[model samples]
Target: MMAKIKEFILLKIVIPIVDMMMGMKISYWYKKINKLNSLSRDKITEWQNRQFRDLIRFAYEHTVYYKEIIDKSGYSIDDFTSTDDICRLPVLTKEIIRQRYSDIVPDNITKIPHRKHSTGGSTGEPLRFIIDENTWGYVTAAKIHAWKTTGFHYGEPFLSFGSSSLFRVNKKNRLHDIYYKLRNAIALNGMNMEDSICRKYIEIARKKRVKYIYGYASSIYILASYVKKHNVKYKLNAVFTTSEVLTPEYRQVIEEAFDSKVMDCYGAHDGGITAFEIERGSYFVGYNTFCEVENPLEISTLYCSNLIDFAFPMLRYEVGDAVVMDNTANTHYNGQIIKKIEGRTGDIIRLKNGHTITNPGFTVVFKQFNVKAYRIKQLSESSLVVTLVVLPNFKKEEESKIIDTIKKYAGDDCEIRVEYIDQFEPLENGKRRFIMSK
Candidate 1:
């Protein structure tokens, strides 16, 4: 009752004024997204065909790298009449994005309202990119639309377990405090999901009547396991898991604990792909991304083309995930369908003192450095080795900062060592694993 009243005021009144002040029309995009969600399958596909052609033409004219690639491939921009023509271009890998970052971005970037962003380094290789405000607004709208499928209304309280570096509030910012309060969000540090912390989160959720939970799959699974163990009495409308693989076992446990559906969401932000599970075993891919499957027999890789992001367009970008594609008709949505996503399977690292560091947690400190790739191996519970493949701009002093930041999580008594390497040896599975233990 209270939540509905707050939602009415916040969404209708507060949000518009905030949008007007900030010069961002996320609400406008949100309304458009709701309309897009109701479009017919054929109409959505037609829209995608047009958007893809425009994006390709824009990339060829604005970006140096795409112009060279298209020219060298003996293909003209006019040839991209349909979305299928994207297969002709070479796949844009993480290495290409890193080496040719400047050439890939447009010359008129200074005039755009974009922010510097980095991937969570789930694959042990983080790619930094730019996302304009337009793209940001669309993504936010799409996310809210996805949440609404689970009967979640905006302005309702929710619990988020994520990286402390990203979600933790700045003590000095009163506005941020007010924003979280108004939004009714409680963010707990996912890196340290100890039993005590998990218990406190459950208490807060029970007290606040938070019907939604969102965060990394492994972190949520850990909390779910604790809930099931203690026989905690909690019921939620939905559990939204992202940023990591949602295993069958994890899904069963989470759904059983919450007595609700677990909505799995996938987003390759750099490549601008987003999908949300609307039903069991059926994921609805968003209209803004044209997803293509490569080598699909049992498992396959995904190549995503961002149809909306014109400022920094990633045409046919390799997302580096193995997924199962559903060939069934798009009965649930106007867009494409994915059967299951085999995302980055994150592992939990336990310290000698019983503290834990979750997947992509260490990736936070590496973002401040110019390190290209990194791996953390636990030689013993107390001793650790960090191997890094750094770029030319990587400074020597950044090494100590990595050690200090890690020790803050792993503990002050933990023995840490850092190693620099040209590259990592190829794995048998052909995937990079960052968190490992001997």
Candidate 2:
């Protein structure tokens, strides 16, 4: 009864008041700033380079981890003549962050208050990290930029299919929830993606008149499928997919269902929002992050330093994701801008027999077979279970061809079993894993 009363009071009272205050603050900044849309590529590049140098120097001076490296190598921040100099620094990985979390933080800025963030164990291990309040603002600004590209107005209503840990619904959470509802978004718990739950999602969007939709690509695809099959109509301006790789097939379904173009955005929890679509159909790297593509081919890794996250300095932090770069000449910078992003390093699966295969490899094989959706499960040392949602056009001959391809890639001795299903099971975080190891 107390919980019910709290929910009513917070949702009906406290939330509306907070939302108005926050909205006014954001509006004030929007008015003071010059329009970013007016800036040319050269102007943006110039701004980003200046911010990059400052961040690099700050990290070298304050963070013990980066300071030690600079001192040991007898190098100063001045040695970094260009962004290319970043390559000279050692690549930072998740393991490194986990092991030396304390040392990486600056001693001078001790006890910096930060907001906690959690990543779904999509790679079989969940990770928790912290970012400063200002870093959070930078993320919000990136979202605003992306939304503007999609024709969304400031303070406009949009739906976001994200997660929250605050179950048992207290007053604070209830208030937050109501604020989201008023802003035309409903935060569906990412941990649940059952058909019934997804139905609720569709219902909310329909009622709220949400203009744009954004969330994990996999979850959005699932919701798109539900909308298509049910013939549900919701007038949406655009769909922005993030966090997971947006496949061509998923994009098609989502576009058809929502009657809107699907745009892809890429970022990480560690304060770097570097990619967004411009009015032109091409993606522009946001002015906030200094980004570099370490290697591009079968797998591409991104190295970035956040200009905004001064509290926790991440200089040349290697974010482990693969990407494809465009052939365009970056006159301002020396490297090509990233054209396409594939999947993460964790998305790749290594066979027991020593053969390493990426998600694209499986995608190629699945497309040839015309499978609707599939998941590859490494069952044992020498066994694989390929769970597929068989399409109406699937045939026995196609199955044989798929098996042959799998055997060729995985080796002759490996046991390959195919299982057909109506649909793939959803992960706890509302993501559908295309591959899993058991």
Candidate 3:
């Protein structure tokens, strides 16, 4: 009864204000998904099968890009009855998105405003994709559902160190600034953080009694290192890490520092792969996202088919992450468990000013550049070598702007060398590490 009262006042009341102000109608999606999460395994499977069929048929009929691929392949949409037959179709890659950019989107996307997105260029070349109302509507809904996995109740505050685009404090938006505070969520600059900022981070966390902390594994690991060294304590309920790979060592440091469990999360830019850690080596994949493991013996890429994203069908989309699994989860599949997440890991770099930051954090600097791909490496204590594969349409002036952004974080004394390249060298496993520090 007390929980219900808390839910009514905090979730139903305060969260609704976020819905009203932001106009995302997040509460509607949140409530709907909460009930669906309680359904039987058989029921969820039945719904997923239906959704899979609907998505494949819709894509084959509507989108020209899917049409060519389906027509070329001997298999019909009828063959894909479940996850069993999705492999009959060829794996879709980021290269396909680049080739068939215009034709890949549904023809009726103009019916409502479409949101544009791009990958972080971590996996490979960053490819721009479009998400219509359905994509915007359901993906955020699934994310809210994923939040439950972090032990976060609806109304509790979260101090997020997310992508600079969303987290940056925009002084121009006065109304939004007020609403941001009221939502009990605060966004801190993860990219350019130093000891002074990290100290403020712990201070705010302690003062607000923030229930959760969200950031990239490396970014939080840096903060965790700080907290452990100083022995600062905050009433932290959980630490949520995402973006880069969450190794066991990083998890140990972060959890110990915050005096809370670290919950690792995985999601893709294409709105397909969504998962949150349930136990150390197990993650419960979101109900809306049906996943099939590809190359199980090797890199173990996840083919995510988003049931809710009809505006852009993500049928068997290869979200860039490698993994291993086991039959330990009884609820979702027959004990199907994600035993490990084998993504990229690198050391954080110390700037000339004696401040340290995650090397992957530098990816934010290259966001404005229309480069096809990039990789950053710490050459020495105060030097970085950035290799970029520029797109045909990229401008020269953007190069200067990117350099300025890097220097803003690393300081002017950091020996910076920008190398324009036709292509970047991939690792032995064929995946590129976005950041490398010796």
Candidate 4:
């Protein structure tokens, strides 16, 4: 009962003494997500239409912005042979990939592997792209089959309250602290979280054996509202919310403060979109990726054709968020599900050490700089109001480097008020609250 000898020295003596001294194979993405969850649903729609016609014939044979938007949308790859011509092309926003991220990359920059990847101006600014290794093994096998729908296993013990996932257990890289202590993680930095480091990881998650507690549904509902107001006896087998918008009152307060059960994984980080959840809360948009709706069944605007990155070819791409679909899908992942995924809210700030962070740490400080839109308004608990909309190569020391990166996380006795907007006014259900805190 020494919490079962610290779960037997972290599962029988430090995980096989750090997986046989780092020969590493930590379940290798749980055996490629159990062979993609033993396929079927017509062999995942014939391997998603042969990986969407081999990324539309490798983006019209080695991109040039997908051969001038598929030769000016007269569409071909023989009119997308299947997936019903994914809306005969057109819909790749984020101001057309920030007005052409150098002609949507890929000028045969192939030494035959890729990786740059950026995004933290969450659907408005910061975008850097390029991801290979077969689109990171189908976005890490659809986030380990959406954390195997809450019953997560394979050497289980995860704790990602994101905003730059804080890694600790004294890391100074000794094989990255024995690879995050044999992959039984303990990352913290949910944008500066710390109730004495969340009660020292809730007393080492009530002794070792911790399993699944994912991130950013407003920083895991501010660590389940301080572990349900200090009655922190722990135990969890599920809680995977992602980026934001979980609301059913934050999924009944993150399922009554982590007694557990609440899996959500709606996507975007421009890897097109994933949409995990598998029933009762819907979301099955799997079979890699291929979805559309610029206006179909209301809260529209959501186009994606990311058959897993294909070295930056988000074909019908527009993932600037706004979804809603209850059905449809003539195969490939059985039926289209995805009902409700409103525009971004994963908002939360609270810092001065009491800790809580959101929107992956304030959109990575507006990633360098250049904007066509921006927002962040908290108004109290140490005021803030920083609306911006510049971009004609904005400069004035980049508005004092964007108010010194929002006064480095609205602290230093917060009072950051830097406004400059020529436009932007759409709430009252017309969406646009990239991060708000009333």
Taking all chains together, each candidate's TM-score versus the true structure is: 0.90, 0.66, 0.88, 0.35
Tell me, what's the RMSD of every candidate?
Answer: 2.7, 12.7, 3.3, 19.4
Q: Candidate 2 lDDT (Cα, whole model)?
A: 0.61
Model 2, position 362: C-alpha lDDT score: 47
Q: Which candidate do you rate higher for TM-score, 1 or 2? A: 1
lDDT of residue 328 for candidate 3: 41
Every candidate's lDDT: 0.79, 0.61, 0.70, 0.66
User: What does candidate 4's lDDT look like per residue over 133-206, in tens digits?
Assistant: 45554564566556755657534667766655522234534754654555565665666554666777667666
Cα lDDT, model 3, residue 252: 88
Question: Which window of 10 residues has the lowest lDDT sum in candidate 4?
Answer: 21-30
Residue pairs with backbone overlap in model 1: none
- Top TM-score hit: 1
In candidate 4, list every pair of residues with a backbone clash: none
Segments of candidate 1 deviating more than 4 angstroms: 18-24, 120-122, 164-181, 393-397
Candidate 4 residue 156 Cα shift, in angstroms, is 33
Candidate 2 lDDT score at position 369:
55
RMSD of 2: 12.7
